[model samples]
Target: MSLIQTDENIIAQMDSYMQRVSELAPQIYKRRPVACVNTFGCQQNVSDSEKIKGMLKKMGYTFTDEPIDADFVLFNTCAVRGHAEERVFGNIGTTKQLKRERKETVVAVCGCMAQQEHICDRIRKSYPYVDLVFGTHVTHRLPEFLYKRLTGSGRIFEISNDNNEIIEGMPLSRDGKIKGWLPIMYGCDNFCTYCIVPYVRGRERSRASADIIAEAKQMIADGFKEIMLLGQNVNSYGKGLDEDINFSKLLRKINALPGDFRIRFMTSHPKDCTRELIDTVAECEKVERHLHLPFQSGSNRILKQMNRRYTREDYLELISYAKKRIPEVSFTSDVIVGFPGETYEDFLETLDLVKQVGFASLFTFIYSKRNGTPAAQMPDPISREEKGKWFSELLKVQEQISRAKNADLVGREFTVLCDSTAGEGRLSGKTLSFAEIEFEGNENLIGKFLKVRIDKFTNLLQGSVIE
Candidate 1:
């Protein structure tokens, strides 16, 4: 089957979603509207915020960085960690004071946090001042929700926890014109013992491969030079689909598209990091040479407890294979410092694995007990103090490794996508290997690709543009 074929019903719904936005535009523009959206969480939430901004902009809303200055204020939230949820509460509380200052200002909250039943109930009872509350599934319903609020319906709540069909053709207001996010699939089926994603985000649902390819083509046409395909686990891209196309095939199709743009994807589970996918990354020139494969804990005992379905040996083998195929490939990973019942030896194993892998970087986190997850009920005997110490030690080791790895790039010339200008005559962009660098360049270099030579390393790689 060809890549262009998709379910007619799904396409029709996308058209309907866009049509509703168009219809709501005139009514929304009747009054001048300024919006401020504070996005919290992963790239998926960022992508959702972009669509929200697009719909709001289409309805004649301009943006303000200050939430107090906006006629409409929205929080695209995250529920992945306790700290993020706390920040959401803190920000939402501030909005209540803002509402008192500007009685006409609309305060709304949406995303993964809003999808939780307890979170919805708490907001309804305590945060009565919130104008609208919705979930991830019904993001396209913002226009309808706003219409209800404007017509004096008071507080609006529209949260759907179902694994709803993917809504395509929604308007997008990307953060950058040159770099974009394209979601190949939604939700996760991998219910890792420590995760709440499968519960809140629902099960896996892949968009038609054709739809993804078409989006990439359009992104290129729109002058995007980089596209990152997003998912909870991109390696499982086509499992639920009827089509024969898998992640590797999809990558090949996007790589073949007519464009000078670079391609990247993220959050691969070690269990699903197939041989074909690894080889495909090495083979595709447009694909970035960096992979973010999360090995939460290096102890096989902890891995089994977390239900990761892969052992330390398995993960090491995969990394070894990738490095063998592409010698210069850099790897980054996520590690949770204090998973329930993790022993000191388990933590040591993690440090040992860090040394063995020599990762470019690590996103380390203290294990936060999500209420409904299996690990929450497990024996979490580890104290906060111990977790803090372990976290610090782990970070110390990873930082040293990262510094050494970056130092190795000191004399290298890399093609950097000139993204923006930093203060004091510095231009900043990222290498194809995802090394962020600050270099001296003209302001006009923003949004263009340029070669840069690495000269020094500090907080970020300091460099100069090679003429």
Candidate 2:
């Protein structure tokens, strides 16, 4: 709804800076620059940080473990929860001392929080030690921004509101060797009443289907065993694209690719998750059996108030359909308790839904109002104490369900790609259904998918690898 304001003159200047960096590449290579990126929030922010690392690596800047030791420090931030914002401010405040210690250090802040105009203005007034402030849209131009800071003087603020630009073939520094996050789409069109995503992330725009398929093939070739398609709403993948493709078609194509890897996706809205999509997921051998469909509230009244566009009955019907089609499939969902005007009866309805669905796991949160959203302006009659009670109750119910569901898999064997080595001969990985499982194995087993027997359940599902 709100577009980022930028003039042609500023755009030209940015382009010119990039050109100057390229022309002066030989001279710039004398000193090795080190950068440190501290990321917060969701998996999407992690993916963005990987891209930032990639761009910086391309610019001949190596990474550092300590923010204070690095010549350039960047905070890739989040604004979803209030606590995450508070942590960012606290970290940035510490950077004031880091800047004072080394005056030449370039301290920057970017991501969803930086995209907010109000946040940017506040930082400019309060934290002048920050050398640069950018946003989600201009990640590809980090080298240019860095060059301007190095070759010139003063603070730089360039937070672009528009996210429509798609720069392909950007370098990436991924965290895991066996698993990777592939973003099939960018931004959100569904402005949920309590969400700040549409305001910060911009409109929904999907990558070309062919481009996605190509990236999948490349990842497979690069030895990644799993790829989770990341998006705000993955079900609505090819909405405004020129091609007549949709998410179901894309899954079919990816599954058909010759590979031994697993395919997964996240954050599906029950409203946009069509029956065809569920059938496709069931039929695709590579597609995982775990689904993260978020049902914000069970009360139809609260759902209407949030503009979720679906009823409790609709969600249950969809779950019933998916389970019948793929009986082994597991369901996970997000629940927001104590929304504006949520009643005791409404809270009971939510608990009832949790009982009926028996979700493998549920991410429950007490609703926190975000600025510039419809729910923020609504009359929130529910008090913090009442919300806390609801949150605790939801967690108790879901924990019992999760434990019992996991308890069912006590003797079952599932394939696990060893991804991490916990100390003392323990290796951690995940099953095809996205169940976290750790087993006793050596480092040599890392990156290999082996059949593991489910032995126990503690903080996470435990198992022993079978030859």
Worst 10-residue lDDT window for candidate 2 reads 1-10
lDDT of 1 by residue, 238-314 (tens): 97677898999999999999878899998799999998998999999899989999999999999999999999999
TM-score of the candidate numbered 2?
Answer: 0.94
Off by over 4 Å in 1: 1-30
Q: How high is each candidate's TM-score?
A: 0.94, 0.94
Candidates' lDDT values, in order? 0.87, 0.86
Residue-wise lDDT of candidate 2 within 35-86, one digit each (tens)?
Answer: 8999999888999999888767666678887987788899999988878898
Which residue pairs show backbone clashes in model 2? none
Task: Score residue 455 of candidate 1 by CA lDDT.
Answer: 96
Clashing pairs in 1: none
